[model samples]
Target chain A: MKRIDLDIRDGEFISLVGPSGCGKSTLLRIISGLEQQSGGSILLDGATVDRIRPRDRDLAMVFQSYALYPHLTVAENIAVPLVMRRLNTTERSLLGTLLPSAKAKRKEIAGEVGRVCDALSISMLKDRKPASLSGGQRQRVALARAMVRKPSAFLMDEPLSNLDAKMRVQARGEIAALHRQLGSTFIYVTHDQAEAMTMSDRIAVMMGGEILQVDTPDQIYQMPLDLRVAEFIGSPKINVLQAALTEGDVLSFTFADTANNRVQAAFRPEAARLAGIANAPLAGVIHHIENLGADLFVQVMTAGGNLVVVRCDPGGIRPAIGDKVGIVMDEARLHVFGTDNRRIEGSYRLEAPL
Target chain B: MTARSFVSSALRHTALLLIAAFALLPFAVMVSTSIKPADEIFSETLRWWPQKLAVIENYTEAFSAAPLMLYLMNGVVVTAAIFFLQVLVTLPAAYALAKLHFFGRRLAFGFVLFCLLIPYQAIAVPLFILLYYVGLLDSYSALVLPFTISVFGIFLMRQFFMGVPDDLVDAARMDGMSELSIVWRVMLPAAIPALTAFGVFSIVTHWNDYFWPLVAVSSDKYFTPPLGVMAFRNAEAGNDFGPLMAAATIIVAPLLCLFLLAQRRFIEGIAFTGIK
Candidate 1:
């Protein structure tokens, strides 16, 4: 990763969000000590842990594949870390079952496993193998296995990517609740921005092996530092119109070789509204409409030959396809970007006669 | 079923039975020869059943005339030793070759494949000379030592281990298991079918092995079953076919019982190896 640096706070639920092959999963693996970073060292709680093995790192990981031992029952799989750490070789053997100390340890491990299973609501499925369980249930078992140890942190690599859409929404809430209850450090990696936006305390937007921006979900959506971050974090992506900035902070936009007109610029779809055709400054033909129950998004082919999506209220008059309509740019909500795609400050009033 | 299907089924069964009879014809001859009286054996007429049964005399003489029992015991000891030692050596080697990345890993695997191409018979003379120089000749060491490092066993196990997912090993490592523990506790259990297949191959090869034991051993105490059966063909027992057949039956019985018991698993294991 090219000079990527990140600081994960204690007891914080930080998400690493990016597209595929953006080094988000690789970063998580490096943190878990599963893969070593060639150039940098990782410090856990002020200790350099780069030399430590994964087993000794005192961190638990939930894999995308669930990675449960197929031969073992759910309870046994959950008890594996405890068995490895608390019991010696002889104590884990068949003969050791007869020893009093080993018996006590085994009983303690069993109780811990039961408690973790109860937490995940998978108590009744303790005797079943992973293959027999459904995908969601197997995911719970993987979570139980990771939770039974109560390690320093939990590193999850797209743990819910294998679940169905409905299950993913439910699992998102459950994981957020889990983080709240455990209050442990969680470094979750995912390619889904919605998952990161909804579940993380802070989302780190990664791209091209670098973290573009790190902020809360609201801040990331509202004030993206990079153009890529702004486009990636929202659905029906933020529209960009090619414009040239003239003197006196006046924005000049031209549509299809038409004469340039001065206007206040806005990027977000929600900031544009339909206005009366007589006095409205911008006009576009309605190309398509998407009705998502409460909100209707209208896609318009602007006179500039650019497609722009405008979020319209469901209760308002819906524009028909191929209808020529005027657009009123919300002056206060407009985000002006310079030629470099960086947000430009000192916005002026809308120059259209409304 | 329908009439036509029934007729086809009958034809299939008839074909299978014909093959079974052809396979069992030699065993029938061995049994009939062991039981027939000496005069009946010389008679021109072919007798399917023995006119007189010499079952008791033949079996008793088969055991008493030569140390047939001793030879059978030696065969058991040598084969068992070879199998156990081969597994003990091959499992780790295969696991390393399949999973671990180290210096010379590709070169080492290449050497294993190269060794597989060179038949053991081609190296037998050099092996025998080495054992002779080490003074291990005529002992069980000479019988068991040469077969210990089975290239086929290593190759089979490596192929089997390759099928095991890397996630399992990573999980085991994250569970605080050492490399050795992963080999035995994780990979070994998962490779049981392949191990069973290799076990059958190794045992059958070593148990019926006449040439190796013939070259390595000369003493009566260390003679394996096939060598003992050959001993029954001495000049003194010139036409004594009864005891020879009895000894042959005893020598072949254990392997046949083993194959019958584990035939399905053996076939599955061999089939898995062939696909890889």
Candidate 2:
């Protein structure tokens, strides 16, 4: 494997988004020193941490399950990292010898813990045990525990995935706010495109074992560099139509000389719209319509025998299923993937999203 | 009572009462004679109850007749030392066997399990000779050290530890805890019920132990309780009944106190760890 040339930027939140088994978790563990990479170097703060133990890695991770200690109350669980750092071996074990000064450390840890807990709105639940906590509370305490450590960087792996939808919405903001407030580097991993879109300063889209593109979430959504990434990042999923570059950027579709005849063209749902056939660039039969509360995405079977999904207002009337409808896409939003399955990265521009 | 249904519940209770009576009979006799004058024990018929209470006198004379305090102190020291050292030695061994991925962990654990099959009686001679060679023959270490690294304790703790989630260990590691601290903070704290249960088993078994201690310590000054009980046979080569029953009663009290306090933990420990 060749070396990865990543910019070791400070105070940045880098999200690694990919399907499961993409080795994203393994990569995070390697960077955290919980696992060693087979053949790559990880530099943390410009120092190699691959050989160091996880305890010395100057990093903290909140797990997917929130990994709270079952034996400990939330307060004690949150204080574990602080206690591990501040106490000597004997002082840690003896109950009373350190209990006096432990008050002082407790006050300080509690203060920091309180701030994080309050930020996460888990302050009232601090005295309860983890077993008694709801999934969201445990997730918050897990975050507070990780945050109170004040590590040089934070490594989180799908921290919000365990919560209910409402709690996930609220927790994502708190975590993003915490990253801003602390100004520390964060390496987040999730399969959630929305989480990646909303939280990260930059998202690294990984596939198989390699990073396909590392860019802003806007760049990832609007201008994906690979066919797999474009198909992966949306809800109704970006529709891929069989298309080709016939004459000097004037592309058409044949569907079966498909041999290297430009296998797929991809576009976001919002990139295409219904147009009257007299003025439409493409024609298709309306096959499916998904009406989300605020928006509707209508899927159509194109003339070339591929589905194209278009996003529109729920207020507009939709074409009946199996009804032939004309579809028009902004030419610039059209993306062609060559037979090699890589995005054709030459010049094409669409009108920007209004 | 009628003959048919009369034997149903009533006979069931009668049979249970007889079993209870059978089990309690020896204990009743021991307590009865321990408080009775010695000559009455051999009387023509068994006395259902003692005619006189001489428990105080018997107890006082029992301790005064020998170094009972010294015997108890030795027993306490040996049991406490073995229990403490057993925990100290077995905890790390158990954690390493359960969680650490060493090159020969399977082979090592199998070998540790192999130690279980070797009987103490078969190895007693070599152990005694080794203690004698090291000049630890009359010392408490001779009695305590051989039993400290308990194969059973390691095996029990390892079985309990295998249930702990690997993610929890990884979380501890990510929280900046050293592996040793993780055992103490995370593993051992969560393992208390099972440890207490094993502790009771170890204490009760070692407290009643006399064979190894008798073989290792020839000096009466280092006598443990059961060995102290054996002193009765020695003192009664002339068939002196007065002191024999008293010493036997003396040997039984500590075990009673230990069990009464730890009985709940003792029985439940095996089920708690879900291991043998």
Candidate 3:
């Protein structure tokens, strides 16, 4: 990962958001010390934990696979980290059960496990094995294991990816609520931008093995510093149209033949409006319309041969597939990216009359 | 059942019964001959039952013929020791070969596979000479030590361990389990079926082994069950088929009981490796 400079604050819910194979999971593993980085050193609470073992780092991790011990029951699985931390080797053996101290420690651990299980609302599943539980239950067990220790930080790597869609949404809310209650640092990694946006205090959008931008979710959605971040953060994807920037920094979209100073104009589907084909600046034919209960997303194939999605109110201007339309993007919301794909800073109004 | 399926099922059962009888014929003869008197053996009319019963006499003679009990004890001690040692050695080696990343792991595993190709008989003479040089000839160590590091056991267990997920190992590490603890606590519990399968193979091979014992030891005190059968044949039990077969049945009875006791686990172990 080149130039991945991220400083996660204590008690901050930070998410490393990116597409798959963008080294997000690798970065999480490196932070957890399960993987070694080639060059950079990791700092944990002001100390360099580069040479420390994963368990010694006082951090908890929730894996994508919910890597609970299949052989152990839910209670025992949750009790593992605590048992390892508290009990000595002799006290953990079978013969050690006869010792009074070991027995008391074990009972204390059972109580701790019970507390975490209750917190996750999985107290009834404490006696069951992981295989017998559902995917969501297993996820809860994994979460219970990570949360039982009350470590310095929690590192989750797509913890909800294995669940169903409905379960993922529910789990996303629970994890965010859990972060609030624990008030410990959480570094979540996910390919789903919606998850990252909903759960993170600050989302670090990564691409091609480098962190492109890091900001609050509102800023990431409103003013992304990189074009890739803008494209990746929104569902139904942001639309891009090829255009040229003329002199005096005026943004022109009508003429198609001008090739000098080419810039890609991008906007979210909600930021653009669909109007009549006669008076709007950019004319196109309605390619497809998606009705999602309260909103209609109209995919218009512009005359310059670019497809743009414009969100429409379901109660207003219902257009069929073959109808001609025009896309009038909000001038202030249009992000202009230069040829290098970096966000260009400007406030150029549209040349066409509104 | 349909008539077609009934006929096919009948044909299948008949074929299976024929094969079963063919396999069980030697055991049936040994049992039947064990209870027969000398006159019935030479009667030439192939009688499974004798005109006069000699069960008590044959059993007594079988017991009194040679030091059979001592040989059976030796078999137990040696086979148990070998199996225990093989498990102790093979598990860690298999876990390392299957899970750990290090230099020459592939080369080490290749050596194990290469050793699996070499038959025990091929190295017997050299092993015998080495035992003699170490002054462990005619000793229990000679019997148990040579078979301790079973390459076949290592190969079987390594194949089984390879199917175990790397995430499980990483989780164990994150849970603060040392590598050795992970082997014993995690890999060992997960490898039960493979261990049972290896146990059956190791016990059967070592318990009935005759060739190695014959070449390595000259003392009667170190004779295994098969050696006892040989000694019983040579020591005043010549031409006495009744007591000989009785002794043979006695020698083989323990293994039969063991196989029966572990029948379910043995089958489960043989049909292994779906641990997901």
- TM-scores for candidates 1 onward, in order: 0.89, 0.84, 0.95
Candidate 1: stretches off by over 4 Å? A248-266, A275-283, A303-305, A326-354, B1-57, B270-276
**Number of the top lDDT candidate:** 3
lDDT of 2 by residue, A110-139 (tens): 787777778778778888989888988898
> How well does candidate 3 score on lDDT at residue A94?
91
lDDT pick, better of 1 and 2: 1
Stretches of candidate 2 exceeding 4 Å from the true structure? A1-5, A70-73, A90-128, A242-245, A248-254, A257-260, A274-289, A299-310, A321-328, A347-354, B1-66, B174-176, B237-269
Q: What is the C-alpha DockQ of each candidate?
A: 0.57, 0.62, 0.69
Q: Which of the numbered candidates is closest to the native, going by highest DockQ?
A: 3
Model 2 over residues B1-276: C-alpha lDDT tens digits?
Answer: 678788797889999999999998887777777777666768788786767666777777678777888888998999999999998888889999998898999999998899978878899999999988999998888889899889989989998889878778899998777878788888888778778888887988888897888898888888888898678467733454545577777777787887788778766777877765
Candidate 2 or 3, higher TM-score? 3
Candidate scoring better on DockQ of 1 and 2: 2
Which stretch of 10 consecutive residues in model 3 chain A shows the poorest summed lDDT? Answer: A250-259
* Local accuracy by lDDT, each model: 0.87, 0.81, 0.89
